[model samples]
Target: MKSAILQEADAEQFAEAGFAVLPGLYAPAELAALLRTVEQAPVSGPNFRRSQEVFAIRDMVGAVPALWPLLDTAALRQLLGQLFPTGCQLVKAIYFDKPAGSNWLVAWHQDLMINVSQRTDQPGFGPWTSKPEGVSVQPPVAVLENVVTLRLHLDDCDATNGALKVVPGSHRRGVVPAAAIAELTPEATVCAVPAGGVMLMKPLLLHASNRSTGNRPRRVMHLEFASVELPAGLAWREGKRLMM
Candidate 1:
C-alpha cells in the first residue's frame, strides 16, 4: 500500500495525462505468481480472435487471494475512490499475451461501449441491443464516467514488445475527429515500464498497441472498475453490467 500523499499524487497524474504509472506496485515474485495462474487458465475458442492471445478471469478478486492485497492497497483504493468516489466494483479482468510474431495491432479508439450480460434498450446501454456471441455494445456516458482501467505489465515493456502508445491530454477531448487525427502528427508517447509496474488510465483515453517485434512475449493484466449501480434485472456478465 502506498501512502496517502503518494495516492494523491497518482490521482493528479491520472487527471493530467489521462494515465499514471506506478513502479514496483507488485514484487517480481508476486507478478510471476499471477502470471503462472493466468497461464493455467483455459483459453477460449478460436472465435475469440480479438487479441493475438488473450484470456479473461471474471471477479478475479475471488479467484486469487494474492491479488486481494493489491485491491486493499491504500494507494490503489485511493486511486479508485478518486476516479469513482461513489463506490466502484470490479467489472472485468483480462490477460493479454502478445506473443512473438503476433501481428495484432490495436487502433486508437475510446472504450465507448461495454456489453453488459443480457442486453436491453435501456437509457444508457447502447447503440446495439443484444450481446453478440463474443461482441458487446457500448455503455452510456454515465457508465463510461464511472469506469477506470488498470493495466499491469508482467514483463519489461518497451517499444519492441508493443508497449502502449497514448496521446497525452487526449482524454480532455470528448471524442476525436477521424479526419483531424489523420492530419495530426504521428508522434505518440510510448508507455515504457519494467516488470511489476502498473499503468492506470481512463476508459476514454486514446490509446493503442502494436505487434510485438521483440523476441519475448508481452503480457498484461487489464482490469476495469465501475461504481454505479446496475440496471434492474440485469447483471454484469464478467465485468459487463446488464442494463434494463
Candidate 2:
C-alpha cells in the first residue's frame, strides 16, 4: 500500500480532467505476485470471454479472490474517503487482458451502465440489457456522475499497447450524444501507466482504446466504486461494501 494520500494537485486534476494516474504505487515483487495469482485464478465457466486477442472476466471477486485485498488496503480506503466523503463501496470488478495477437479495439463512449443483481422496473433507469456478460441497466445520470473507476495495471501500458484515451473534462457534460463523442474524441489524450501504477477515472469520462500494435500484453484490473444505493430490491451484482 502507498504510504501517503493522493496529492491534492492530482485530486484537482482528476476533478478537472476526469482522470488521474498514480505511478509506481506497487513494487515489482508485488506486481509479479499479483500477476501469478491472476494467471491462476479460476474464471467463470465456459461463458468466460477468452479470445486470441483478449480475455475478460467480470464479477471478479468471485473469480479472483486474490485481488479483493486491494480494496481493503488502508491506503485505498483513505484514497476513496478523500475522493468520496459520503462513503463508497466496490460495485464492480473486471479483469481485462489484451494479448499480443488479439486485435480488439473499443470505440469512444461513456460507461453509463451498471451491474445489478436482478432486473427491476425502476424510475430513472431504463433500457435494461442482458447478455452473456450479465444484466446491466443505464442508471440515472446522477449515479454515473458519482461513480469512480480505478484501473490497476499489471503490465506497463503505452499507446502501442492499447493505453486508454480519454477526453478531458468530458464527464462534466453529463450523458452525451454519439455524435458529440465522435466530435470530442479527436481531442482525447492517451493515458499510459507503468506496471504497478493505477489510473483513476470517472464513469462518465469519454474514453476508448486502440488495438495493440506493439504485440505486448496489457493486463488491467478495473474496479468501480459507488456510494449510492439502488431503489426497491434491486442490488448491485458484484457489490462488496468496503471496511472503511
Once superposed on the true structure, which residue ranges of model 2 sit more than 4 Å away at CA?
1-4, 43-47
**Cα lDDT computed for each candidate against the true fold:** 0.68, 0.85
lDDT of 1 by residue, 1-244 (tens): 4354236677787888888888777777777677776665444543233344544444454445455554345546665655665666677666677786677788877777664667555675657644233336677666776677888888899888888988877777765676666443275688997898788888877888887787877878778877676678555666533221
Report RMSD for candidate 1.
Answer: 4.5
Estimate, for each residue in 1-244, the C-alpha lDDT of model 2 and write its tens digit: 5455679889899999999999876778777777777778765573357777678888877677876764355657778888778788899888898997568899899998998988999889987999765789999998888789999899899999999999999999999898778888878999999998889999999999998889689999898998888897788888888655
* Top of the candidates by TM-score: 2
- TM-score of each predicted structure versus truth: 0.79, 0.93
What's the residue-level lDDT of 191 in candidate 2?
99
